[model samples]
Target: MTDIKATVFIPTYYGEDNLDELFTALSTQKVGFEYEILVIDTSSKDRTPEIIKSWEPKFKHFRYETITKPEFSHGRVRQQAAEKARGEYVVYLTQDATPAHDRWLYEIIQPLERFPQVVGVMGKQDPRTTALPLLKEEIIRTFKQFGPDFGTTLFYEDDFIDSQQLFDLVTFYSDVNSAARKSVLLGDVPYQDIPYAEDQKFGEDLIRHGYMKAYAPRANVWHTNEIKLRDYKKRMFDEIVGVRRVGKTMDPISILFVIKQVIRAVTLGSLFILKDHQYTWKRKLYWLALNPLFVIEKWKGVRAAIAVDLDDEQTIVKQSLESNEAIAHGKQ
Candidate 1:
């Protein structure tokens, strides 16, 4: 028997239904070297662990562990998973999202092996077919507003880049699909308080550590969570608040930032109306083009996420990286 050099990380929270699909997809991963599968379950009340129990018989290298205590937050759970990892590179994934490409796992780890300076690699995030139209439209809209004309999709083929540019790609620290070395994280680099800011803060920390964050276009995944304009705005607001909380709790920032971002939003949002009018109008048009169907479904999704007991499961507003359902149904 030989040891695998890489580990695939799945941070699951009541993802039994979703895990089945992702596990099936993972089976086809290109095998250059041996690999280990680490399923980090965050103590879901759902049947997710039971699902893993059944898979255990089928997979030799498959391992599963749960965080029995619900007191912890998302970042804490992620840190727990990172601690459990024993591979050269760890692949972080949302339990619901699926890898669109088989080479996704390989492409993400390749940079670290090839370049010692590359500390992390992030993949391109595309909407899966299973994603509802409202989700699809709203996601595209969010990306557009987050970084207009940056392209509808965030995949790029660059080997080396500065931290600021990497931050720009992330649209101000949203860690949707990303990977990093296990050695860099396990010991002292404590993650932020919540699940949300961990990725952004890490990329920033790596930047501070004098390492390069690489972006891989080929390594792609589909993340699903569809919301409409109102929902998108709420998500954005949550995002802004999260960042501000991190700033206040971890390290205090000057009044200059508050003043700067407010000005940027007011100015840039209006500029979006002018030079970037096409992007803004299309988003508006998508809202209008889809009519009530788009609006209702998105509103439903937003409400679904809100209505769900957060402790029980991720907001029903879940989207898949490989969502065939959304594509077929045309609803979120």
Candidate 2:
């Protein structure tokens, strides 16, 4: 079994109900070859640790470890996990997601067995049944976010700044699903400099640094969650800020670009409130009529992105706590 080495890494925090189901699905799969499981946890205040411990027997190869730094977001934390991983290949999946089929693991890892140049393979993310809207919306957001680099050139090109097809890059990447050869990721924690944007940075860096990225759609997974519209807008703003945070290290124009995007986002979101989604007579009328508030609200998300600083972790922590609680209350 040592001949074909592979490992699955699940980095988690606050994955309560979803983690249990994901592990259960993993336990039933027929992975006869030598493989290992690594779960890097950030001091979870939820039931994630207990769930992983319960599956120790079912997943005999699973190794669970925790890191307590609150400053590192999930993506950075994931890079930290990869540093400690011993497998020749690393398959990454979010706890809220589960493999869609039994052959998922096989399909994801097979590329490396056949092609030595393939440094990484990230799977397609398809929502189960009623969740297709989330997928579609995410596609739209990614298409807009990534601009022209969607599908054409293997890597983002400065020459094609307005290319619209590059949305495929986002489609190919899901924090919920991905795999990579350890050789490509070793000592690559430089991508983890922000509160988020690790996956985008990781893929971009791999391509820039001489590794090739692969998209194997057959290795699919079903994600059980979606960001609400408000949350989605906020998360994007946060990611934009994360990008700017990193960009400042490389170029200030990048930060200016983020500011431009935030301004554009405010305009785009306002238009949506006024023109898109026929939610209801009352909602449509109210939101459209009160476009100023909608614009203001979304802009707040953009500002929040600029406000986060590594040295001021507590300040960001307080805001994150408030935002999370607001979302919970809204859902309730």
Candidate 3:
């Protein structure tokens, strides 16, 4: 058997609709070395299993396992996948994050293959065309901070003065499109059993332990969640709460702060919408007018997240979209 160079690990729940495109893209990857696809399904009631079965014959090695929804944990399942991987590296992708090009797989694992010191590599994200203007803009802005879209940037522990400095610059590591060394994952920097921001925490852990993390901008994925207007606040709240669990916190909310945030969000969002060429003038005008409402809801969510006590499960359950989903369907 050809030795597997990497394992592409995806943890899915009700991802039947996305599997076909993801697998089709994977099949076309230009990776010169051998790799395997491993999927762990959280007992999805949809056609997820059937989809996986259909794709089994397309790859030399394909593995799938099913676990009850209640048994799924973002960090625990990923750590288990790393342990089970037959490759030197493990590349992670959420079901909806499809590779943007044939070179994605090769590029993402390139750093791990070349730089023995790089414990992890994060790929760039290009928001799907269906993503909202604000969401697309956020994705672009976030990735731009790392470096040029076609360049490679590396982060090292020796460059930062303190953990705060490290967190400020490099804590954005995302498993949505990322690769890491299996040995490091299994050894000093296993994913923690946390509900949110496990990827960021893992990156932080690796850097703190004197290891390096790389950002490969050429390795990109089309990823986004189409959040409804009504659900926007809940999503933001869930995100803030999740980051808090991973040791990142927001300042306490005040009326003055809320006012300032609202003004900032509206002004910046309006300008972004007006400047974006993707939308038509009519659509831009519409979004420009509606931007204030979304911005208001966003600040409301931020305020609620900052004010709520994390230990209060009841409050968290009420405010968090993820908590509600987990409670309702036993999946995160």
Which is the leading candidate under TM-score?
3
lDDT of 1 by residue, 1-332 (tens): 57667777777765776788888777778868877788877567678888877877676578887764444555776666667777777777777777886877777677778787776777656666545444554455654443333222232324454564454454333345667777877743545567345676765666656667666656667778644444453454344344433542222333465455445434543343334333445554443444344343334333433334444423322432112222333322
Which model, 2 or 3, shows the larger lDDT?
Answer: 3
**lDDT (tens digit, per residue) of candidate 3 on 164-282:** 75565775689999999999898999999877778878988998888889999999999998667787898889878877888885677778876876676578877877777778888
Q: Candidate 3: minimum summed lDDT over ten consecutive residues — where?
A: 159-168
How big is the RMSD of model 1?
A: 10.2
- Total clashing pairs for each candidate: 16, 7, 0
Clashing pairs for predicted structure model 2, backbone only: 148-163, 149-166, 150-165, 150-166, 150-167, 151-165, 151-166
Report the C-alpha lDDT of model 2 over 98-198, residue by residue, as the tens digit.
99888788778876777776666767665544332324335445434432322211233344445334433532344568788777677542345445556
Which candidate do you rate higher for TM-score, 1 or 2? 2
lDDT of each: 0.58, 0.61, 0.86
Off by over 4 Å in 2: 1-4, 69-72, 132-136, 139-173, 187-193, 227-233, 248-332
Q: Against the true structure, what is each candidate's TM-score?
A: 0.64, 0.68, 0.92
Better of 1 and 2 by lDDT: 2
Which candidate has the top score in lDDT? 3
